[model samples]
Target: MDYIANYVDAIVIGGGHAGCEAALSLARLGKKTVIFCLNIEAIAKMPCNPNIGGTSKGHLVKEIDALGGEMGKNIDKTYIQSKMLNTSKGPAVHSLRAQADKVEYHKAMLKVLDAETNLTIKQQEVSDILIENARVMGVRTITGAIYYAKAVVVCTGTYLKSKIFIGEFAENAGPDGLKSSQVLSNSLLDNGITLRRFKTGTPARVDKRTIDFTAMEAQLGDSKVVPFSFSNSAASIKKNQIQCFLTYTNEQTHQIIRDNLDRSPLYGGKIEGVGPRYCPSIEDKVVRFADKSRHQIFIEPEGVETNEMYVQGMSSSLPEEVQIQMLRSVRGLENVEVIRGGYAIEYDCINPTSLLHSLENKVISGLFFAGQINGSSGYEEAAAQGLVAGINAALKIDAKEPLIIDRAEGYIGVLIDDLVIKGTNEPYRMLTSRAEYRLLLRQDNADIRLMTKGHDIGLVPDDIYAKFLDKQEVIEAEIERIKKVFVGTTATVQSILMAKGSTPLTSGMSLHELLKRPELDYKDFAAVNLDGPELSDEIIEQIEITLKYEGYIKRQLIQVDQFKKLEKKLIPENLKYEDIKSLRIEARQKLLEIKPKSIGAASRISGVSPADISVMLVYMEQLKRTERANDASVS
Candidate 1:
């Protein structure tokens, strides 16, 4: 009997956020893409929170939207609530978050997938990758069906050898009892890929009707909702939003957790994966912060159509009985029934050092990896990587140039660079603090920062590109207008300044100079016939920040210039680090194993210090001068 198998330009393993983004981007770019999943119904499933975007994470969603990805747009369509966080802080930290109707989100994304011309969604577990002579040829599913592909993306997320833990009990399953890809672990190992175990946990889901809203502070979404996509239809996103309640876990809640600590998989040492320190489970919280009397617990509605609510900040793998006890002890959750138990999931991912800046494997040419499979923990982080990997994969097949993002541009760039360079020991999560040039790289300007790249890669549409250009023009005009406006110490201006606690101007000063004062802004001098062009709040914000932090921003830009110098000093693909004189033994060994792309990357790797970078920089410089001298003589 002759058997037939399907062929595609790209095979994306896993239908999670990372896989979905990778598959969609590839298809939209005209590649024949197939997305392999454990369950078709679980496409774009939110295994944990029934929400999207927060702080730095929101920046990612907007950037994805700017790049023509579907997450922000889909989330906007299905969101039950929306809010802008860090309002009291600077615009750089203001993040948009939305509580979504989970079912609707999944359904909406699936419809997009179904409508995509070149993408096929298949319900199958990818068990093995077919790599020959260091280039990916195809993938083999668990059912033994071999799908031929020119390039393959392994976005297995936390599904490879997944283990879910509740208390001391552990079961081999993905987040929602889905089958683990055990065979894939062996396959990755067989290919000489280095592996690491990492863990992430989700809190219990509660019956929404049981929570007492009166006992908690009502958290409301922003009134003027800003959609994630630059192409978003302005057909009013405002609606009656769901309110999340905040309650505190008292001494009793902590005591219950402390008493039952040994029963937790994390505390019991039953789970081996290195979990993220920032998003630790409830059991970890109690153990690490014994002195804290209470912790904030947020009760968030899962969806408008369902009565389920999420118990935030109470994530634990404690015994079921103890979980019920501790949850009930919380302020507003007195009679909360345990609809689902909180648990931690451990899974296998490759040490990202094994991957290149392009998210493609150096050893396996056409094979790429992204998301949790690369040890990054957030949905935003995963999706961002997926876009990069998918783009590079298509470029690989097209024999076009690969895309690489340095740390200065966007958080996505910072994320990939950190993952490949630092080689995280624990599950990597993106934090705004991780970005070196945070002052310039902010959530507010993600579209401004990366939309051009998206356009260049054919991800962003021309209409969106035009809008970005308009936005840039408006910001520049407003800044110029403000710089030209002048104000004097007239009674009107002096009185207004006095009222606002600003020092009286000594003769006359430019309106821009007054704006640079800590107390006054351009908006405050509205009476003086504003000098700069009239601008919207958004554009005004850009003007103010640019004027105020111009010097600091310039300094960081200089640092970026110096950094790129090292980043450009590429390590020869087959350079023998061992042959480099005065290089430390550990440096030589690590350099050989990791095979970093440049001196900057090499400097970040463990055992390679500033001294090692200097040595490498000098060697590369000498080689460069020699090559130039040789070229001059030839000419």
Candidate 2:
């Protein structure tokens, strides 16, 4: 028997968030790319949550959009309800979140993938990677067909030997009863790739008809919707949105969960995976916070056209009967009929430390990994890694320089750096709190921070890059004008302040200074007229933030300068750390184990300290001196 032969510039294993983005990016960059999945209809499926973007996840979506990825545009076109979370707080925390039409999201993404000129979507399970020596040659599907490629990105998210459990019942299945790739897992293990099992749960989908709206409070989306895509005109896409409901899990609901704790796979020793700490099961929440009498459960619409409502904050793997019992016990859900029973899924994930900063395996060239396969937990997190992996893989194929986002630059940089440098014991998820420089990495400025990189990588179009340049110029011009323009304590200014409920200024100050006031802002000073600088709202956003957080931003900039110095100090790949006598045992062991590319990456490793960094610096200097002496002698 003969098998078919396929060839492509790049191959992506898996068709979820990471795989979709990675394959699409590679194809969009004009590379011939093939994406293998169990089923094409399951492409870009949101198995766990019906929505996209929340808090820092929103920042990732926007950054993905700026880089010419499909997630933001797909969500923007399909979202039923949209919201800007944390609006009451500072602008730094403000994030755009939306409830996407799940079915439509999948359809829209598949359409883009299918219509792309250089991309092919395949329905097959990849069983093993074809490796020549230590470098990835390509992948072999279960049907025994070999497809050769220059690079292969393994984004096999939560489907490798996946098992779903509900109470005492368990079966091999990917999330949502999809086909699980069980054979490919042992193939990876045989090839020396270690596996770590992680667990994630989805909430029950309830029939909207059975829900009692009168007993629950209505949660509405924000009147003004913000599109996640940078390419979108922002104004043209705005429209009327859907509403979500809010219900509470009372003490009765807790009692039902407590009564069946023994039956839960997580509580029982049935699950052998590390679950996400941030998103816990309802059982975990009830047990962990026993003192609390109630917990909030969001009734999120799965889609505007569908009758299924997602039970957020209530994910579990209780038995089907228990699931129904638990749902009915919640206030306003007395008659709820579950469209689908919730369950916990345990699947294989790799230790991210096994990969390099470029998301490629250090031990195996041309072999790359991203998303849940790297032990990350969110759709946004997965997509971010996919974008980076795809970009780097494409660059590798073309002999161009790989893209690297540093920890100080954007959240994507911080996320990948953390994954590679400080490997996680649990499934990794992105949070604003994870980055010290989050204020500088807000969603509003993601395009500005990452668009240039995208442009350089050939994903961002030249016209879009030019537009970004124009926007930057306008922002800088406005800031300059504001700094040069001065305002006096005139009645006009005083009246404006009073009207806006701000304290009246006793003395004159620069327009920039006035804008920096916590009580007074650029919009508040509309009553005062000056020709020095007139800013549009979007442009003023950048100016106001820079002026307001000038001190913090400057301090972070200094920190970044120090970071750059260390990052600039390149560590030779073949250097023998064991020969360095001055380095500490722990530091040397860590440096050799992680094989950090730079002194900066070495420092981020957990056990390595400042003293260790200093020691390494001195050792590197000595090596440089010895090298120079040898070169002089040779001359």
Q: Which candidate is the best by lDDT?
A: 2
- Structure candidate 1, residue pairs in collision: 481-532, 482-532
Query: What lDDT tens digits, residue by residue, belong to model 1 across residues 490-528?
Result: 999998899899899889887777777756776777888
* Candidate No. with top TM-score: 2
Lowest-scoring 10 consecutive residues by lDDT in candidate 1? 229-238
Candidate 2 lDDT over 330-393, as tens digits, reads: 8889988999999999999888988888898988888899999998999999999999999899
- RMSD to the hidden true structure, all candidates: 2.2, 1.8
- Model 1 reaches what TM-score against the true structure? 0.95
What's the count of clashing pairs in each model shown?
A: 2, 0
Model 1, CA-based lDDT:
0.85
Q: Which pairs of residues collide in candidate 2?
A: none
* lDDT, residue 151, model 1: 93
